[model samples]
Target: MSSIKVECVVKAHNEIGEGPVWEEKDATLLYVDIYGPSISRWNSLTKETERMSTETYVGCVVPRSSGGYVIGEGTRFAAVDWEKRSITTITHVDTEKSNTRFNDGKVDPAGRFFAGTMAVEVRPTELERKQGSLYALQPDHSVVKHLDQVDLSNGLDWSPDHHIFYYIDSLKYMVEAFDYDLQTGGISNRRMVYRLKEDEGIPDGMCIDAEGKLWVACYNGGRVICIDPQTGTRLQTVQLPVAKITSCCFGGKNYSDLYITSATKGMDEEALAKQPEAGSIFKVTGLGVKGIPSYSFSG
Candidate 1:
């Protein structure tokens, strides 16, 4: 580990900025402003941002192997062609629960999109009812339910070798590991790989580094903590200017830069005033590491 430099790269004050994915082909970062209900593409060098509006809450976005992006649009899954600015509905999820919405997600090694949902209203008793679940949208356009009884489904990623899956249900204050079969897209043997103390903040979105370490964004914790899944131990922590750290991904020319997203959703005016960078996109460099390139959805 080395001294890392964290800086705010984009100053867009997003209410809830989550789900960051790197588009390697374009050398750009694609993320969603869930509250803005918009998709954003940021060019690191030029610092210019392009936004595409969505009809409802946009939880996550990933590149499609064919073209454009496959997004979790509101209560349904859809495909967006940036060039045409057109969105085509792929499928709808949890239609019976009008209050539930898609939150954080990522494409698995097998090209399946794994996204989870959370309730819009964060009441403690309501959350205790566990109004969330994790779903895997296959390359064939089929959706499969993996886990149920989730409170706040959040961070998700896989081990570098594709044999292990890592997920976060934020309200649980822990990260779960699953035995993943890439060939069949099956997950089993759910176990807690890491647990956070209440004071450490809840685990939100995460990504895996090349060395097989899980880098998790700590919501309301003001940092991203790197944990070694094998031993369930903390490795390093990268401090940020904001407390509502939502998500992160590795991008840039060399794939060593970590791009982080934050939120300003639950802060008071006094708290927001003190942390002006609460909703900005942050970048952490100087860590001697690299990350596996994010896979695009093949469907």
Candidate 2:
């Protein structure tokens, strides 16, 4: 395996830049600033950026086959018009309970939106923490609770063959795998694929490369690791200067450039003083891996 080296590409100070997806058609990188309540697009070729704001916290954003984007925002799913800068709410989740909000999410191969919620308060009691649930938005705009009792639902991705699903609950510090029935949208046979020691930071957002390897952002660990899912073996580690690596995705024309997003949200003054590039976007060249294409909102 080759060594991973990250270099700063876009230095926009994002408060909580999370989910990142590459739009191949537009040759741009699309990501969300959760607390900023906005979705931003950056052109890899021109280095120009455009943003669309939302009324509530934006959790994730993905390209839609019919054009525009599907965005997960504070317990609701919406369609965003890039040209018009408009947002239309398609469905709402946990509307009555303001204490639970959307966290990390992604679109499945079938074009359905999959997003999860987290407790609003940082220190919720055991019961409140269990309120976080993973939701699936059907093509008809109907929603279903796929999984419950989740705490800090974060990383999500699918294997290259599309036969397995991987997810993470940050507090648990484990990356789990499920037998994914893609045609029917069923997940079974859950198993732990990766677990980090207490010294290593919790896993955050993740992506699967074409070789079926998982690349996970190690929050507070200041690194990204490539691991073999079946064997649970660490292939390589890419070090970063910042301690809070929020998420990463493969982009670039050839799908070889690895783009990473870090955060400065939870860092204290002392930590920020030491790592100034905490919230910057980084690009690592020569990754020698290709990522799966972003799923479009066929629904």
For each candidate, give its TM-score against the true structure. 0.96, 0.95
lDDT of 1: 0.88
Error (Å) of candidate 2 at residue 225 is 1.1
For every candidate, C-alpha RMSD to the true structure in Å = 1.6, 2.1
Top-scoring candidate (TM-score): 1
What are the per-residue Cα lDDT tens digits for candidate 2 across 171-245? 888889999888877788989998887756879999989999999998888888888989988887888888888
Per-model tally of clashing residue pairs: 0, 0
TM-score of 2: 0.95
Model 2: colliding residue pairs: none
Best by lDDT: 1
